[model samples]
Target: MHSTNAPASRILVTGVGANPGFGLTRSLTRLGHTVIAADARPHAPGFLLPTVIPQVIPLAADPQYSDVLEKVCRDLAVDAVVAGIEHDLVPLVDMRPRLKATGVRVWLPDAESVHACIDKAAFHAVLTANGIPCPRTWLPEQIDEIPDGVELVVKPARGHGAQGVHFVNRREHARVLCELVPAALVQERLYGHEFTADCLVDRDGVASVILRRRDLVKAGLAAVSTTFDDPVVRDLVVRTLNAVRARGVCCVQGFVSDDGAVAITELNMRIAGGFPLTEAAGADLVGQMVNGLFGLPVDHGRLTYETGKVLTNYVETLAVGDAEAPQRNGHSRPVASPAVQVRPDARRNASPFLYGAETAAVGRVLRSGQYGHTDVTEEFEQRVARFLGVPDAVAVASGTAALHTALLAAGIGPGDEVIVPSLTFCATIQAILATGATPRFVDIDPATLCVTDTLIMDAVTDSTAAVVPVLFGGRAVDLSAVRDELQERGIAVVEDAAHAFGSRTPDGRRVGATGALTCFSFGPIKNLTCGQGGMVIPRSPQEADRVRRMRLLGVVQSQDERANTTTYRVDGFGLRYQLSGINAAIGLAQLDHFATTANERRRLWRAYRDALTGLDGITLVDVGEDATPHLCQVLVPDRDKVFAALRGQGIGVGVHYPPNHLQPAFATWHRGTLPATEQVGEQILSLPFHQHLTDNDIEHVVSVLAAALDASGGTS
Candidate 1:
């Protein structure tokens, strides 16, 4: 390890996927400091110390993704970080606090200079306002914002690497897009050769021309790119840099207008995708950035913009046939391998929406250096709060943590009988049991696949201190009546909204809203997943503080309370259940798109219901008028055969749950029999669902199910 007091002389290389980032990884690895890389794709290449977190997230937008990168620095003991793409820079800049706070350094391009980096409208507005050469641009917010005569391109105000950009000559396509992303930018298409200029600026504000490339991209940027350098390009790049106040590496995109004036497109703050070329040309940017950000020094010959480079990138298809795929969709549903089992929330199977950039930004500060241990966990609080529209959110290490925190916050302890549905995930029962409370498994309602209000009443006893309503398939049991009843009995309610994230109760309220302590799961298999983690949103400040401290290994309160102090001890006992900054970073990105993800799920739910509504021998769980289903579930006859047949075709399906009573640990918790939970356990089949599936995949799944059911002597 490097000396504790020495200035951090190392740099971080993240997102080490393929030979694309190999050059970067190799460069950092050779520097001798601990070089860590993080990527979800196992096939990513290099001397990768691959984990699940990268140095920069949001790739471009700062709506806040720096949190994850910062956390990685703190947790991994990294000294400096280098964002290898335009999408990496801004969020890193935005997270200056978290990074600086941890003493880890990051080089951020001047914001005013990089403002044109992600926001096309902001860039256009800035350019138009400054009389800089710009394409005809206007905000789509105006009346019929599409360009009337010329073909126009529409892009988001703030986006990463151009996700939803489209060009259309017709007005209709522009209008349709305007409806999709409100306050988008419409720019008249500039038909000309596109190019990029790579730059490096030292602390002294001296800008170096690295390499300018002739950007050859197909359909925006899916294909490969080949770069060429020339005087015209050189002049444009120098002028563009001069126009902006950036003092770090920046890649500016521009087009040679038909009139010969170079019309600037956008400025990218981080090293562009073509940075490897800069390295290939002799400028070691990653190493340079590490030195520049931390006040370190480096010697280099005169920088020259290099030319004539060839690079290519290709994606390989990996079949995750049955090896426990992570989550996709508004809810945490299993992966469907063969017949696309898309979750209700995944609209186009476009890689499932990630957590909000906000979470990623904060997580960076929390996780970014060696002084602090790496803390990556699930969205234990944010997910629950979001699902229930609660104002408070706190993430924990696991779903079990969520329940434990909730139980403790609600004052359920030794000798307390917490009425819980025997049909839910074991984590729920385990959480309560960890609080020294006994779980009372109440019968579930077959229609909703959740514990019923009447069952709670039947199971209630003087020892009953709280009631937990467990949900399944993103569908929930009506808990309003039970909640009111429990309140009357002076019992607390901790709703396990683990599987009910996108679900709403009848009367338009959500599952966790009315609960005193609501818990949610974002485990690799639950809604809005992050490998493993959970959340608990309490109703009171006292409960929130307890949950927060308990998550952080039982601290008294915020760092403010413990600042300048050396040690801390638990006042009431706790465990290490704090969510990792890295994990939270992912959760942060995923949650931002939750609403869009949720709506897609509802669409899938409708399609499933409509397709199988009249089928006999199979009962689709009714979400009720008040509930919006997260996962599409059904009770089918010959369930085993249907599941087997689906799997035989390489489709992965799931059983919503096995009754808790069957678990050896629950043997004495509720020794009483629960026939309803038992019966549903055998018949309930969770079809594959996630956002990564196409509509055709869903149709195929329905068709396969229909055929399998008919073969098993069931009618549709």
Candidate 2:
């Protein structure tokens, strides 16, 4: 191992997908230092290197770049950072102060110097001002002024490597290319031998330069290179470095003309791609860089290298496996998460109404390079808690996860019975089953299609561990009279408020604020769409902690906490039910415009109510005024025939649910017949109800419903 004056550090190296970064990572690890290999692409070869920690980060241009980098540095306890590519140089320089404040060391030139080196036009100006010979350059607007018969290179002013670099012998071709390339510039093509100087400038302003000839070049990289001694190239490179006020590890490339004149071409503010030759030739470049990075004096003498040593590189696959092998692995729910499910178009079908800000929010979260439960998810949780006036809200992957997590946190397990109505979605039953609790199906009050306190108490047995009151169609269920008795009997109240997000309880408090273990679905068709997510409002801080731990696979420590240490503890059973930042971002956006959504949904529900008034043989299921209606349901005589006729007439009608207790999956839990729930199940028909529906749409739907009822003989 290459010994150093100081102990090895845990260094983060960006741009590890490229050769320079890939080589730098291996070299640092060889020197007994830990390397965090970071790249924008997940399949970057450096990620597969043994003993190197792989990290996929947002692209440097992403707005969240600095924040994500800072979090990575902090979480991994990184001591220093080194840029192996030019793309990372500007961002790293901009983040230098924040990184330093967080105790992560970064050695970079000032912003002005970095900008000057990266911008081709600026590089040319600096060189010319310093009396150094270089190519004549012109911006795109100056294309017409180019002299005839001169070969030209058209490239981006702020380009790197050979990307967007095109060569042409004619001015017309150059002009056409300048229009095609963004931030394009033209430079006079030079003819001669190309050379790159691997350079390190000490804090004392002294410099050591290693010169290497591009013996065999390919794709802007020196595929084969031999180190050489040349005073003309060395002096010019040093002059160019000093001209731009460059500091730390950098490189200068130029050409040695046939007449022995040296033209400084470009300067890069990072390690050279072929610097492996410098190390092979006995230079302590990286070691001295480490010294300069830690505020220690650089030993310039050790930066010296022997001449005529050669290094060559060839293409070879580092790994071959499934491209999706690097997926974010976690325990996903047995049911598909909402984010992946297809959603209906708002204009054409009953569907979620996007407030136009959701895409931008999701994009921002995606660029943050974190998908799992994070600060974004936490922000969503806090916002929801504030909206509901609750102590805390736990966000999970889906609505089923919310119910499952809440039930588990409430101590509902095997041998316990949960009293729930049979008139709700199958997801409710599945969540109860997932917790290993038996569901005691109960009858609902036909008027509200929600279970009554009397029905709940009548079904409650000595074995009843909890009572899950499903808020059907955004209508709240009031069980206050029996709540004391249920508590006395040690039965917890876990509310399945999937459709009652903005509804109020009997006491006029928000449904989730009534001190019950309430769950809300931010699914695609809910009052608020999180693109498919759920929230659990815990009644106590202890319950919140239980759900939090259970969502991330029983890990006591959070994702951030686990990053700082080498190991973590699993406190109990759990699943991969954590809400991803992507979904949380969507939820945050929806919450911001929830008031407008509530108003529109209420207006549409009223429109349907007015149109259905005095309609024969149809009874409107009441969702109280305090509720933000999620569905417009009516019990019609001959419901099956009317439902089919409405579908045939394109009215977008559906059955709320079949009695869950009678379904094949829940047959074992069937406790005889729930007469009211059974009647509602057969008669209940849900019309198209969403924020997108207008009075005109409702009128059209009501007219179609009237026609369908007439066609079905108008009676049961």
Candidate 3:
């Protein structure tokens, strides 16, 4: 039944592959609520439901089940959880404290109460203790004590769904069946009319039950059922619920003899499979349960239903397709290490990859107690210089600091202007501003989001003291055509190679080795992180010395040299931008495995390229073959709506930049309209690209992207 007055909620329904969970998910969605349908099977039928976020989880018995469920709830901000099967009841009861901290509400009785209901032997004991009529049961060891002519039902004690249940007339046959079944228990088989009660117990120990007779049964589920009221059965169900202290939604099953004798057999702490019939008979079962789930009062008056309504169920095909797992690429294996590391964060725009050695290296540095510019820092600088085939590399606090000190070293000041692309990160513009030089924001090529030679040459002026060509998306900018011209005009070229750490120029030289003053960021989420550091590739020995001194507060002497004397010399203008030895140690550990990181990134990008082929209304932003791609972006129509749709599905889509020229911080320096930059700003969307992604993850992302585009009317 649809309840218009009930508040819509974000509820997670588990065991969605089963009929109870599947029907519940559909009904909740029909009532205008958001549902996160979860199941242990990847191809569960409920996953195909409209407007539902589908998630695959571990089985209830797995140790990682609780942790994964908690992460899903916290990540999706789910309000409440409803289990549609009995397998999850015990685990959900145990995870109460943990799930409570994550702000997910689960309505269940205490652990003992749940065990008593799920365990048949325990259920018999509890009902018998309360003086309620129930079937006589015995453990596997006591099966021989049964009467000779009594028909027996042998089944697993802690099982559900009628699995592994058998009927036999003799004690020898029952004993043999008990040996075959796990945790076996035997009970006297009863011959009577069967019925199931759809029940809801409020917090005040009061229960309202609507009874339905199993007119036609198959595989332990009612194929056809009719709702009816009987004082004797309702009284027995209420007693059973109170004896177990049941709360929230639950169901009770038992036998009704022709002589009016009632005997309860099963009590499951979840919604019954045939609950829709109760709703069809005019009962607000799910709605009132939702009220009690969120701590509102359950209205028992709403639980009243007509007695003559009938419901017939048939097995219909919900979905038909493949069930096998998708194949994986060979290169998609995890990083091999001496110790384990956490998986990469695949939801962010970008994140760092760490090998196991980084922790040990950082520990060694901590033990040394020399966190200043020490031998470790110098070793990191030399290692980076050798990798880029450069004469020297200077380490600093961050990529922004590298740009600030490098521009200052290049003689750019308040009266000067630095030409930079408006399509780059804000930090690039702020770095130039930090050197007292105003930014001459220029347009990009729109294909690579990089400044071309023609664009840079067109923006040059007499006040152009330096040109900062941003290496956007790890694609190097080729300024070869205007390099000599800019030099003749005394304009220095400083490469903002923050995203181009391992990328190469067109001439087969590494980006940092192109003879331009290059800066590489090793920030937390960069391709290579020093935790929080950056590097500068200087053009000459003199430039290297100047940047080195500038990073150490303009001190002319090194740390070792200063220690030999009373004081250090403050020779020139500088800031405290020196990279700590601890950070350098992390960088050193990363350098040893740089080759694997680069290969993994390139492979993941190609996976995306192959998956997105032939899709309409999507133009992938190009990064040349030689470039070690830092980001995977696509230009699509209606990007904002597409981004929101994808994010609603938890795809982690983001916008790399929003045009620095249009930003208020750089509004004063806005020269004119940048048509290409402005248009590209609205169309570019960054997909999640990182080293930890496998081929299967890429497939899921692309599939979701297609759906999002179709929903936004972008794929026309």
- Write model 3 residue lDDT over 1-716, tens digit each, in one string: 33634466668999988988988887776554567788887657776665466677888998888888887787555789999878888899999999888888889999999999989999999999999999999998897788788999999999897789999999999899988999999999998889999999999988999999999989988999999889989999999999999999999999999898999999999999899999999888888888888888899999999998999998766444444333332212222222322234345566666654677799999999888888999999999999998889999999999999899888888999999999888999998988889999999888889899999999999999999998988998999989999999999999998888899887789999998999999998788889999999988888889898899878999888888999778989889999999999999978876765676677778888988998788999888887888899999999999999888887878898999999999999998899999999999999998765545567888998999999988895
Candidate 3 residue 356 Cα shift, in angstroms, is 0.8
Give the per-residue lDDT digits (tens) of candidate 1, residues 156-230: 767645567887887777877878875577778887777766677777666766644455565444244555666
TM-score of predicted model 3?
0.55
- Compute the lDDT for candidate 2: 0.85
TM for every model, in the order presented, reads 0.53, 0.53, 0.55
lDDT of each: 0.64, 0.85, 0.86
Clashes of 1: 61
Worst 10 residues of 3 by lDDT: 329-338
User: Number of the top candidate by lDDT?
Assistant: 3
Candidate 1: stretches off by over 4 Å: 1-367, 370-389, 557-563, 624-628, 670-672
List candidate 3 segments past 4 Å from native: 1-346
Would you list the rank order by TM-score, best first?
A: 3, 1, 2
lDDT of 2 by residue, 401-494 (tens): 9999999999999999999999889999999999899999999889999988998999988899999999999999988888899899999999
* Model 3 lDDT, full chain set: 0.86
Clashing pairs in 2: none
Q: lDDT score, residue 684, model 1?
A: 89
